[model samples]
Target: MTTQLITPTQSAYAYPLLIKHLLNTPLIYSPDQEIVYRDCFRYDYKTLGKRIKQLASMLKAQGVKPGDTIAVMDWDSHRYLECFFAVPMMGAVLHTVNIRLTSEQLIYTINHAEDDIILVNEEFLPLLESVKDRFETVKKVIVLSDKGAIPASSIEFSGEYEALVSDAVPEYTFPDFDENTMATTFYTTGTTGLPKGVFFSHRQIVLHTYGVMAGLTAYKSQANISSADVYMPMTPMFHVHAWGMPYLMTLLGAKQVYPGRYEPETLLKLIVGEQVTYSHCVPTIMNMLITSPSIKDVDLKGWKVIIGGSALSKGLCKEALGHGINLFTGYGMSETCPILTLSNLKPHMLEWGEDEQVEIRCKTGLPIPEVQLEVVDVEGNPVAHDGQTPGEVVTRTPWLTQGYVKSGEQSEELWKDGWLHTGDIGVIDQEGYLRITDRLKDVIKTGGEWISSLELEDIISQHEAVNEVAVVGITDEKWGERPMAMVVLKEEFQGKISEKDIQEFCMTFVEKGQIPKYGVPGKIVLDAVIPKTSVGKISKKDIRGTYGENLN
Candidate 1:
């Protein structure tokens, strides 16, 4: 059968899906809607539109041409949001510099991306000063400061961010270009070696924003977001564009508050003062917010948060529920534009009690709109959807990165067998819930059996004394590998519970036939904290590197 095709009028306008169009709805519908940055700055969408033009003019005056890379090193602020649109709309690539990477990795990304201009926060001046000589392609630097003060530095300054925007012509028009033009590039440290760069087109980003919007609002779950809800982002703007929420929220014309630098007190204050109703962050940030002394003083009853970047432990889900913060899991990686699934409950599941819902909330979740996900065995065949058998997760999505920038070999491996290999071990239930068990590299292979580190971590996290926990396999002579736990206890219980106590707690689970007896950690190391990646996931890689050899 042949498919029918339709032809449009010769004079009909062929609109392209560009980032600039995202601005139009907001400017027309919510022109006066406020976009706030900490306690200092606040402005409306109309002004934001003008400022975007001003920023583009400023960059143009500084010789930023289409295809040039413009990098930003500021915290999550209105300025960063401005760049998110203005740079791409101008046909240049936006490089969101990961401020958390080590100095070497940071310099490598800046150089690797061939950034032509960098809008850097004033606080990071010393970092650039110490390594400016190493930068290979950075041609200019614009200072971003809350006080509008441009401090002295060894590197030649292009200008202060606001001053340049204020002086540049605001009437310059944004030209239309191919929707497939490269719009943004950011390095992801999800892989080994140096960071791998992921590039996305304007069309891909637009579709992704729509995909996330539909996924969040279409469901009847507690985490649904609407235009009436106040939105703030707890994730760093540099990480997958804060899971691409800025674009989604902007398109909705929702009120936005950007908390600069993520100070606990400031985050809590903004939430209460602005009545922030919707936000997203890693589990670590949620843990920090709940454990903070200021949290008790603030009211968080109606706030809705989505926890991603790592698994949402059932213990954390229960703890957050007690504080009246609505929480759920979102799953993805940098390679996937960072949003493949969200743990939004189905209509029927909403009738279940909180305890029953927590189980669903902690699963990796159902795939978001336009995402085709599957758990495949070693041979690339689909696994049973019984939720017991584990397999590697792979996906096909409109927004997945086409390839890693400039690295042919790595890109091939990433898209092997025509699917984007997630390198994650996961399972799908009969009801379509996907639960990630472990990273393929992090899974423990011990004495002819497999033990999931995530499962062990979940069990340990439920203990009353446990504040944070990470379980990794250490080399063992008899078992080939054995589980080891590095734990951090709550302040009140730091001195009360010992390592032996945690081992006994896991043994109780073993007695219930929850985990196998051998699954208990052979050694438990209580510490002040567990190591975390730049995006706040538990750093099991670092843990194993530090203790893998000596612990056994």
Candidate 2:
């Protein structure tokens, strides 16, 4: 059979899948819905639409043009949400700058991105001032402030965010362009070298919004979100478009509460005050919320959170469940538009109890709509779906970035053999659920046996005394490499729990045949806290650097 492509008539409108079109439904159906930014501001979707245009108008008046890179440095806020739409809708690339990056990394990303303008928050002005001198391409700065008064800064400001937006016309003609035009760019928080840039097109972002939306709401699951659900983002807006939820939520016109800075108390208050039903975050933020004193007063019932950026440990899952929180694991990286799979329960499995559900939710999960995934062996052959044999995960999806921006060598390596190679090792069950074992680089090879660092962390985290834990491989004289456990005890157990206590806890799982005896670390170091990546995943790279040596 021959493939036939149809051409549209001259009078027919060839609608491009642009970000501006996402506002269509919301503008008509949900114009009255509210969008809140901390305690300082609140506006309906009607105002949101106007403000989006106003922002675009302001940017244009300041010499911003199509294809220019506009970087934003701010906490998750309504202003950031406005930029998410207006900048890209205007045909300029939106660079969601990672505010948590180191000074050098920050400079590298801004300069490497060749950002033409920066919309920086009042709080980040000093940081921006320190690095602005080194920026090679930035031509202007616009300051964002909650108080509506721009803070005093050393750098020259084009204008204050609110004042400029208020002054600009509320209507601007956003030109139609090719759907494949670049819409967004961001740097991954890599541990080894400088941060690498990943970019996406308008088509990819729009399709990802649809794909993730269908996967989350089309099924019967505890983690499902809907138009009625109140939305908030615990994840930083700078990171993979906040896992692209802000776009999805805006399209649904869900009432969104933006917690400007993620203070534990403030986040808890917003949840209680605004009744935020759907949110997403890393496990570290989950732990922070569960341990917060304010959490005791907040009713988390009906609240749904998607845990990403790291493995969702069983301990964290159970803890969240105990607090009446519906939490599930989501899998993806910075390069895959940050959403590949969701651990939403299958309708039949919805009848299962909390314990059974936790197991499924902790898995990397079934691939989302349109996401093609496989666990492949070293030679790139698909591995058995027995849930025991592990292999590197590879995937193809409409939303996956074509390549890392400007890094052709790494881009070629990432898309080797036509499938984007995810460096994490994972396993698939007979039912098609993927369970990530560990990063390929983090797997501990000791005495000719491979051990999963993630498995060890999951086991150790189950201990009652363990507040947070990370497992990394330490170099050994005889074994070549061995697992080393780093633990932080609960506040009350700080003095009572010893390093030996954690080893014995792992032994319990060892005896149960859940893990091999060799998996138990010989060296267990109790500490006050474990270091984390900018995105809040356990920084095994940093941990290995500090304690990877064989002291004995």
Candidate 3:
């Protein structure tokens, strides 16, 4: 027998309740404790909160009414953190623009979201200047710059963010808002077409924060987090709101660090000097960090890291373990509040030996308590949890975006029957662990059978000479669509490894049918590094654009 619990609507829904833990908590515990800013500046929670409030007031004074969109263009910084709180708490929508996108795409997103204001970093001013005339809806430009000189430009209502916030009162009262009211709008990096928008409501974001903080999730204990744990998220703020780490850190009261423009050396220095305990980024960033010469002397033992944005390869996981880094994998997308599952060890795995447990922790873990995940076939039938059958991963959660902002293509299908359809193909074990096999679009079909490109890429990346690898399906007359491999070799091994040697290596693991008859790459184009999205995933779109015509 079960009892009915009281509903949230039965009680008064309050805005401050979302951040009640932070606002009501003691601000004096670490007055002098520092929140490092890109290894350049630092501030305590007291000072940080003051700036947040002042920024809130400044937004209010500038007529940034509730529900208005205020976009931010910057790497992770204290000012960006302030906007994280100020905009949402003030009942406005915070739009994070992906600076890595082409300038035209950036303008398209700004116009699509109807962003009324943009809080930009000094380093990104030139990009904004290039596209300012195209932003029809943007009314104001607040520059978050260290430079004192303000350039005289055609763009109106431009001023330094520091100057504007310094003059405003640091005590703006947050208004009451419906939990369902939209709080954030983060645009997706359109691999195929125009970028689509995913807007999250206040209630969704607040609940996501709690879900992440829950015992079963990645962040189990708040006490483990303090002002001392330095953070360097390789995940860009523009991508799924940096996997919601900015908000989680503020609630945990941890000192946050951001790598401005993501230099591996700069990140290594910050991590070693600041003693960064926790971080989240894609496997690409991890590859760069571990390979960087600057990190050779740094002590990474006991450092907690959550890898996402793409599948974490076993080879990369082993490299991290060798350095004594506590690394785990997470999986999510721009549409699902960015964190649907984490590879944290479950109760059953706790009894296993450390080595066995580490292996389990490397696969994408179970869903967060509130998240309901399933792997379904083309007919929408649930796949078996035997860990062999693969299906499209779908989910229903409180924090998922309602729908794409304007796209009418299968909006119903995306949230059909109340479950958000994630195009990832994956399998779940009896222990409730999820292991993503391949993206639906990236799966190679040979002789009417599916091959996991992700799995192939993982195997290829293990080659000592290979720095990066991307596998895509090319049109084939006999096999429907055959697998094609594009590789970027390490600097030292460049021009040394032949295509025949790589093909021979792949033949060891996969059967002839499982592997395409086409043994080698149709074409090999060498690059210094793989092109990546802002979130740091290998951009297959770029790869296809460069090689699609040749394949045809």
Per-residue lDDT of model 1, residues 76-141, tens digit only: 999999999999999999999998888888898999999999999999988877778998888999
Error of 1 at 318 (Å): 0.9
Q: In model 2, what is the error at residue 287, expressed in angstroms?
A: 0.3
- What does each candidate score in C-alpha RMSD? 1.2, 1.1, 3.3
Q: Runs in model 3 with CA error above 4 Å? A: 1-22, 26-32, 215-228, 347-358, 408-410, 511-529, 549-552
Q: Which has the better lDDT: candidate 1, or candidate 3?
A: 1
Question: TM-scores, in order shown?
Answer: 0.98, 0.98, 0.91
Writing each residue's lDDT as its tens digit, candidate 3 over 382-458 gives 99999889999999888888899987665776887668999889999987889998888888776697878887777
Each candidate structure's count of clashing pairs:
0, 0, 1
> Cα lDDT of model 2 overall?
0.92
Q: Distance (Å) between predicted and true CA of 129, model 2?
A: 1.2
lDDT of each: 0.92, 0.92, 0.77
lDDT for residue 360 in candidate 1, whole number 0-100: 95
lDDT agreement of model 3 with the native:
0.77
